[model samples]
Target: MVKTAKKNKIHEQLTPKTVVIKIAKWFLILFFGIYTLFPLVWLFVTSLKTNAEYFDNPFSLPAVIQFQNYVNAFSQANLGRMIINSITVSVIATFINIMAAAMASYAISRFQFKGKEAIFAMFSAGVMVPLNALMVPYFTIFSRAGLLDSLNSLRILYAAIGLPMSVFIVRGFMDSFPREIEEAAYVDGCGFYGRFLRIVLPLTKTGLVTAATFQFLTCWNEFVYANLLTSSPATKTIQIGIRYFTNQFTTDYVSMYAAIVIAIIPSIIGYMLFQEQIISGLTSGAVKG
Candidate 1:
């Protein structure tokens, strides 16, 4: 049996079709790798250039490296304050969003009750709704509640805005989780909450991490509602701080690029931390989205 398997493997490796397929896979991987990372490399390069160098040749190397652009992003602008605000808002909103999603998805997926599917459907439908269309009503409601010009407004809206998608992803993951495990937990005298807290929650780590990654990124990058809801600099987020270098009359292009690079760092960090879980979660049938 061992000799036969080895012979088959050697035969497969030597086949022209298999060789061609392997070559093509490597080629495509290289192509996509460059495609995705090229823009980031170009942006970093441009961020180091002066306005004169950028204008003279957008693609050329900088004559003098401008390390001050990064310093200016912090000194000249409120980038520091805005980064803190973004971090605070994103973390709090992600926690709330994930907790709510976990409970909602668990109940909807595990319990067979009348209108449960309908509730899930309604949540799913929210993803299709255009947020721009609701801006007027949301503005009125927040205005009445006096949440306008507050980070609390973003916290609430960000959690609510991504709730639909978060529910969708987590629910899909829960749906595939085996009922037999919970049944065994019940046989061991575990109550519903106990089983969920100990077994279900811990086992769903990948799905939760995936959902949290999405929720955090959404909250971090959200600009439209952040702009509409907050007017004062005290409530402004990093997304709004990126626009600091622009006006009708003039623009600081290099400084804006530097701010953008700074803005992208947290997202890259988040992805690097959760990328394993995110990739596995998506591949494990949680991407019914």
Candidate 2:
């Protein structure tokens, strides 16, 4: 009797409030999952359809899958070359942005110097200055400098645009780290650079990964600067190349859809790989001093 009563009491402890909360949580999860995936699913289906088939049955599965759409899209967009350009620009910019941001962040977080706060405030303000607002100035400057159609121009612009946010994120993470560990390293005669490279960098891997991911994504998806600053196929990024599928009169729907799907694959893979780190870094950074 006592055992049965205890079991009943345990079951009753999970009240209607708990059940409602669980149901709401699952409902939100299901809603967002469908919301996020629906467009990709539609795009994939559309990519498999011919123009006639797409117009005939807009929302249904293709009678015959058109794998050639991907081939045509890849060839027509010169995506192979564009992909190489994007990868190169994104990787180089991301690396430089993270390295520079990490160094700046470390100094800001660890050192006390005149005008340090002012400098950091400037970086924070840079984050608020919309990229579009600088487009004209950047275009004029690059054109006059004869760098308008070069990969180096994109690389420099991407890194500069991403630096402010990267510095903010890395500095926030650095502020959260215990000062005692760094103090101990200093006492042991570790130089400032040595302490930063060995102690700080390794400990802040999540923050670095988060910043790198953001920088890479920004470079990958940037359309305005690439569209304005680059003209040659050799210099254009994937985002700009993808626009070739549509013009004023004719639009290649199948190829356009296929190109879009291909364009998004890298971003998807990147997010999947570093999702945990992004979440952790943001959460920790949010609470830091």
Candidate 3:
């Protein structure tokens, strides 16, 4: 029996079924890799081509690399200011979003109260609310509040808009957290605030980071509300500023591509930084919830 078991184990990976599965797995990986990366590669390549080169053959290699497109995007298009605006708004909004979500999620997950489930349901239900439908009322409210064209309005709106998803992710993690640690902390001369700030917050870092990354990206990439809210160049985000290259008569394709590449870099950087936490948060939530 032992020898037969050993033989089967040894031959398991060499079986036709196993070999076919291995090939299929790698084939899917290669296909997805190219699918996801090709557009980015094409964007970077096109950003280096001149207008004439792009007009001649977009897919072909550039005859001479046009570094000037980046320069023009920064100087002529004022992409630098827009990028800074995007960073500022996204960072502040993400902080606000995550903080509110953490508190709300903690309360919803760990504490029992009247209407708690209802409130949680409300927050979760917010994910179904359409931004487009609310634009008119939101515009009216912001206008009445004297917040139109203001970055603060954008920050607050971005935070509010991302709140539901943040709460959803953070609550999943918080629910999975063992309560014994909090109970222990409570018995050890720790107050409610201390238990939350020191014990719960520290342990929930992965969930917080995952939620923050999603919130930050949402704030960073959001366009329709941004365009609707801000008209001034100083207040415009990187998304709205990307359209400066286009008009009725002509479009600066290469420079637009350069600005796009610039805009994408920060998001990529952010994802890379929190990728591990995000992955852990997702898997842990799935397994534990």
- Which candidate leads in TM-score? 3
Residue 284 C-alpha lDDT in model 3: 83
Positional deviation of 152 in candidate 3, in angstroms? 0.2
Q: For model 2, state the Cα shift of residue 247 in Å.
A: 2.5
Off by over 4 Å in 2: 1-6, 13-17
Q: TM per model?
A: 0.91, 0.93, 0.95
**What would the per-residue lDDT of candidate 3 be over residues 1-289, giving only the tens digit for each residue?**
9999999898997899999999999999999999999999999999999999999988989988899999989987798889989999999999999999999999999878999999999999999999888999889989999999999999999999899999999999899889999999888989999998999999999999999999999999999999999999889999998899999999999999999999989999999988999999988878863
Candidate 2: C-alpha lDDT: 0.92
32-102, model 2: which lDDT tens digit per residue? Answer: 99999998999999999998888888898999999999999888989999999999999999999999999
Q: TM-score of predicted model 1?
A: 0.91
Instruction: Give all candidates' CA lDDT scores.
Output: 0.93, 0.92, 0.92
Task: In model 1, state the lDDT of residue 137.
Answer: 96
